[model samples]
Target chain A: MLPKKVKKRASLLTIFLLLSVIGVFLILNALNKNILYFNSPTDIKISQDINYNKKMRVGGMVKKNTLNINDQEIRFIITDFKNEVEVSFKGTIPNLFAEGKGVVAEGKLQDKKFFIAERILAKHDENYMPPELKNIMKENAE
Target chain B: MLNYFYNSNIFTWIEKLTNFINSIFFALLIAGLSFALVFSPPDYLQGDSVRIMYVHVPAAWISLASFSCIALLSIFNFIFKIKHLTLITKSIAPIGLMFTCIAIVTGSIWGRPTWGTFWAWDARISSMLILALFYLAFIFIHKLVSDEDRANKISSIVAAFGLINIPIIKYSVEWWSTLHQPASIKITGSSSIHSSMLMPLLLMFFVLIMYCALIFLMKYKTEIIRIKKKNLKRL
Candidate 1:
């Protein structure tokens, strides 16, 4: 058996280890609580029953016929298989941004379905060349 | 009797002072985390999502700060042959690893809301990922070596090399078109965050620093005891 003094020291060390682990757990929990998260068009539809004031993200492909480009606001429809969301934004659209492409909109919920976007993120595939150009290159080789 | 002898250890004064300092830092950390929770303002753009900055920024900052501690300790160990410095570094590795993981996890969570994706190869994000890996590698190496002297030597060399990643992580956003935002609060820079947001962030940052300080000191104390026990066994 270890001496009483050694046992005391070991117990002290155990307390520190426990505190450190608790500290990390608390930090992670705090982080999860504070950060908002992205949802697909279908996911937003499911979450519509929950609190709407909470900040969130909606992601989908921008529908081809949905973009209404006016002077200041560029409104569009984002759609997943089962649902679609109308997203309105007044900012510089990303370079690769266009119809029939993946886009994620960040902002608030209004009318239970529409998302008022503060920032619109347009996602592009690794190839910078347009899909049409990529097809053309393939066609020429073939 | 036993209590008297234990309390009268050779470094008792140093231990007392370190404990005092550790307590102060621990208090500040708790205060900061709580303040950040209650008082931080909503973002004009991000709304509630802005609060993620409190945890995310501080995690990133302290991960870098721990590396700074490691680098400094590594240099001291190499130059002065200070066994205490190596002990401090070993004590700090796990804490650093935990913080780095927090920063990455929080950053990803925040990104999902802001950038529409959970993961990215953006320069800032990738460099931070590498940093997390470096910390893991350091811990792994520290564990692998059975010899105390050899472990210290190897880990110090690793620490020295890992210091290079710190600058890269800091400057990656500035150098590249990254989804990650630039520094909101720095020693130099006009902060764009409103006063309400700024206060909580500062408070949380202070708390994280204090947390790191407290853990480091506690670990160092444990290390000293461990070394003494080993010496006693030899005797």
Candidate 2:
């Protein structure tokens, strides 16, 4: 059996190791709070005030029939299916960026609910479409 | 007996101090998000799409470093027959995998604004995807083997083999047609990024590196503790 002193030393080492890890974490946190994740649009709307100049990503689906294209400026509404945010972009649309699709727009908020997008992204699932879409086509023919 | 009490008190104090300070990962996560959110200067050309670089670059760096650790640990285990080395490597798999996922997701998000598409099977993207797959394979093999010794040997071999792809991934942009931009920060040459933007980017990278190191150390320490306990219990 190991001596009591040896056991004590081992325990102390473990404590020291753990403390060192936590110490590093705290030092970094004190320097800058970079780890805190942002909330979705719904959450952002409910909580603290957002600055007009500050940039953030607001995620949601495009509301049906809200997109209006006027030469350079393209405007649309993003809905969490509960609350909607108006998003305007002054650039060419992303290739996958279609109306009535899920999008996450990055930009600053202007007037409440108005987001002037610096960038717009389209999100899609990784998996391929099942045979169900084809099966539906066959059923429609029958 | 007196020495024991004194030592115990020291240990307790250390624990309290660590708890009070908070985790490095938490700090880094906050610093990274905030710096990226506000202070980082916009790109001269891409504008705000430049902001995505804060998250994308750090995540990619972490993924790369973690894989390097895996390769090193695998080699160590293979050469020295260290029992805990493989476990440490295995513990890092999830962290590496998560970093890779973050890199891919953030890269795709950045790509949409700049490249006009969420994805392209460009050289860099394809290589990152393959790296992620290699990590997945590591996780799968670790799960497959029942015998500890055999598992360690096989997984170490697999990890060593996976190292071959890291260079290909790094140089893919130069070797293939890619929408992904070539390296902005280069060795043997000055960085393409301007000084105004580079400072915060470097700061953010440092923060990310610290966080990754802290987490890896924590995970590795925990794995060692758990394995020791299991060995003790078995004996």
Candidate 3:
């Protein structure tokens, strides 16, 4: 077995490491609700802690057939399959924002059902493929 | 023992290694760039902009890996009083900071077309920014602190503290809904990225690792020289 000094130091180091890990875990845990960058439609719909008056973020897919575009104002419904939040924004949307694509919008919650987005950001999944392969997958899906 | 530990033999080795890396670095860089910019197919969605991943992903990865390495070494050195490891940590800190900055900038550039914002205070982005600050703190403490022993001790503790942020950065996407996309590549599970893109990305990562090696060797050699100079009058 190791000497007493080495063992003590080892235990000391272990304690410090454990404490640091636990401390960080607690800190991140406490900040979990605050550090969340955006909320899904379901989160906004369900979470009672959310302040409706404060500016916040809601993110999800641009629901199919919900995209209604006119001059200066674009209206769409963002959904995460469980709940939907209607978004109205007057800004230049990203090139990738399309119906049934992921999107993140920042605004104040007017109510649970409608959101006015000051800034709209597109979101994409991790998958990357060539257009031909993508088309084949789309065809297969259809 | 001190003299032997910092002997000239390692200097010769460093020189040769630097020369060897210099010889092959350009060829590998060219190949990696060509693969990244030309050979790899554009994403079905992002098109040519996806090329940014070749640099951004690798740089971000190296920065994370470097910080972890330094933190581990620093912990050991703080415990064991290993002088050589301190040298190694010092050499690595600048490189880590550089790559962290590169990753942040490249990621910002990639965000415009895809995410529609140059910057956001999202969990992932904010956490990475915190990482850069940690790197800065680790590096600047070394440069600004007057007492070497104190500097090393404080910096080691700082690095140990920053170690916690590593996982936070890694899991920020899944833990919190963020604008940043989740990782496409996984160490254990099957990667979502296709082989074509992955090849260039790995190639670029290899080349950048080589570049980091070159920089690290030079910095280590300089530190060795600086130490030897301090002892020159005695000799």
lDDT of each: 0.71, 0.69, 0.90
Instruction: Please tell me what DockQ candidate 2 reaches.
Output: 0.03
DockQ of each: 0.03, 0.03, 0.76
Candidate 2, which CAPRI tier?
A: incorrect
- Whichever of 1 and 2 has more lDDT, that candidate is 1
Residue by residue across A23-129, what tens digits does model 1's lDDT show? 74575357542322346777667663646686666766899988999997999999876798898999877654678877767788785568888878864321222
**Candidate 3 regions off by >4 Å?**
A1-6, B1-8
Off by over 4 Å in 1: A1-142, B1-34
- What is the C-alpha lDDT profile of model 3 across A40-76, one tens digit per residue? 8888877878677899889999999989999989999
**Lowest-lDDT window of 10 residues in candidate 3 chain B?**
B1-10
lDDT of 2 by residue, B1-235 (tens): 4344224354365455455445655776676677677866665345566777777887898898889899778766665565656766887888899999999999988776765777755557877998999898888887888787887767776676667668767876555434556677777777766665666677788877665655655665567567669879998
Q: What C-alpha lDDT, on a 0 to 100 scale, does residue A124 get in candidate 2?
A: 32
Give all TM-scores, in the order shown: 0.60, 0.57, 0.95
What does candidate 1's lDDT look like per residue over B1-235, in tens digits? Answer: 4244235463675567677777687677667766666655455344465578789888888899888888777755654566666776888888999999999999888767655568865667877888888888878887899887887767776676677678778876555445566665556866655566677777888777666766776776788788789889999
The lDDT, on a scale of 0 to 1, for candidate 2 is 0.69
lDDT tens per residue, model 3, B98-189: 99999999999999999998998888888889889999999899999989999998999899888888998998888888889999998899
- CA-RMSD of model 1: 17.0
Best by DockQ: 3
